[model samples]
Target: MRFFLEFLEFLENMQLMLIINTIMKMPTVTKIIYRLKDEGLLDTRICDNDNRVTQVSLTEQGWTMVEKINEIASLLLTDSFTGLKPNDIKKLNEYLKILKANLQ
Candidate 1:
């Protein structure tokens, strides 16, 4: 039970992390931006057209971190799908698509 809870927590964090990565330079970035900035992974500057607007960019170190994170994520996903038949994989994808469409 404890391991299941921890796994759920990790999965939630992974999903949130991906969402943050997708919109790190927009009108809805998280307050964790400060921590990223402190780590020298994120750089922010004022927009030229609007001094009140802030723009965010990733540093070189940030890009390296993102690449590493993606590699790990790919490994985890690949391992999770190991030894699956091609038809099973296709059926799973189709079910996922149906579920996604219904949820949407």
Candidate 2:
């Protein structure tokens, strides 16, 4: 769910193939996309230029949901880190970046 929302955030519209490539899995991506569509949070259609390609974009409801999700995430993070000092947070962020890079 987070993956789908974050991916849609940067790209206004994405091809289903691109989503599959990004996720490195077709079945999971297809399932999530279809679920979102069924919930009326995503809009999908076959590309006019290429019938074989499907494109997906977020609906207005999806945008609203994303905003709400972000707000909740922010609050959660703030609460979780309430006892941490600024320097502690900065160091944690630096370590997280290194960990992310190592994983990549």
Candidate 3:
């Protein structure tokens, strides 16, 4: 999900270690990338400018899953707000933020 979100934001190939470094450790990132590649959700290639670097991007199926996930999230959000007035939703959001802060 994190990789898909980053890919969606950039829409470009990224270095494997660089992207993963922002989210996790190097070894775990490599393992996860290999798993994702095996699942056909991602693709990796040797970087053109750096022999030691690997480039990564999402596959078609990964994009499809991202779209479906987005649709589901939107549906759930809309359903959750059903019959709520604008002010009510605003207050609900404020309350949720407070709860989140407390949890954190």
Candidate 4:
């Protein structure tokens, strides 16, 4: 499954409960958030207006890691497709489309 954390780049911060309820429904999301916070990738603080709410934001290290992950993903994708000709890519695209249709 695609991770909700993948879209964290777009938001400044998010509430713990909102992240669990709105973005990820699984109970393990709480564990993941706690793990990220413990690893120092995410910083969590009690909300100013509401002490009950915990706000989570990426730390400097987290942002750096995210950038690196994106860079690596891009490089891996480019390397994987490097030797393919135009027709090869077109045929691969057709196969991907059929695969997607079947999945759907």
Query: Largest TM-score belongs to which candidate?
Result: 2
1-104 per-residue lDDT for model 4 (tens digits): 12434556666554446645775665676677788888878888888999877777888977887888788889998999999998999999999999999999
| Model 2 C-alpha lDDT per residue in residues 1-104, reported as the tens digit of each score | 87677668777654446646775687777888899989989999888898877788899999998998899989998899999999999999999999999999
Q: Write out the backbone clash pairs for model 3.
A: none
Q: How many angstroms is residue 33 displaced in model 1 relative to the true structure, after the best TM-score fit? A: 2.0
**What TM-score does each of the candidates earn?**
0.63, 0.79, 0.74, 0.71
Number of the top lDDT candidate: 2
lDDT rank, highest first? 2, 3, 4, 1
What's the number of clashes in each of the models? 0, 0, 0, 0
Per-candidate Cα lDDT values, in order, are 0.62, 0.83, 0.75, 0.74
For all the candidates, what are their Cα RMSDs to the real structure?
Answer: 9.4, 2.5, 2.8, 3.3
Q: Which residue pairs in candidate 1 have backbone atoms (N, alpha carbon, C) closer than 3 angstroms, thus clashing?
A: none
Residue-level lDDT of model 3, residues 67-104, one tens digit each, is: 77778888999999999999999999999999999999
Candidate number with the higher lDDT (3 or 4): 3
> Candidate 4, residue 5: CA error in Å?
4.5
TM-score, candidate 3, is: 0.74
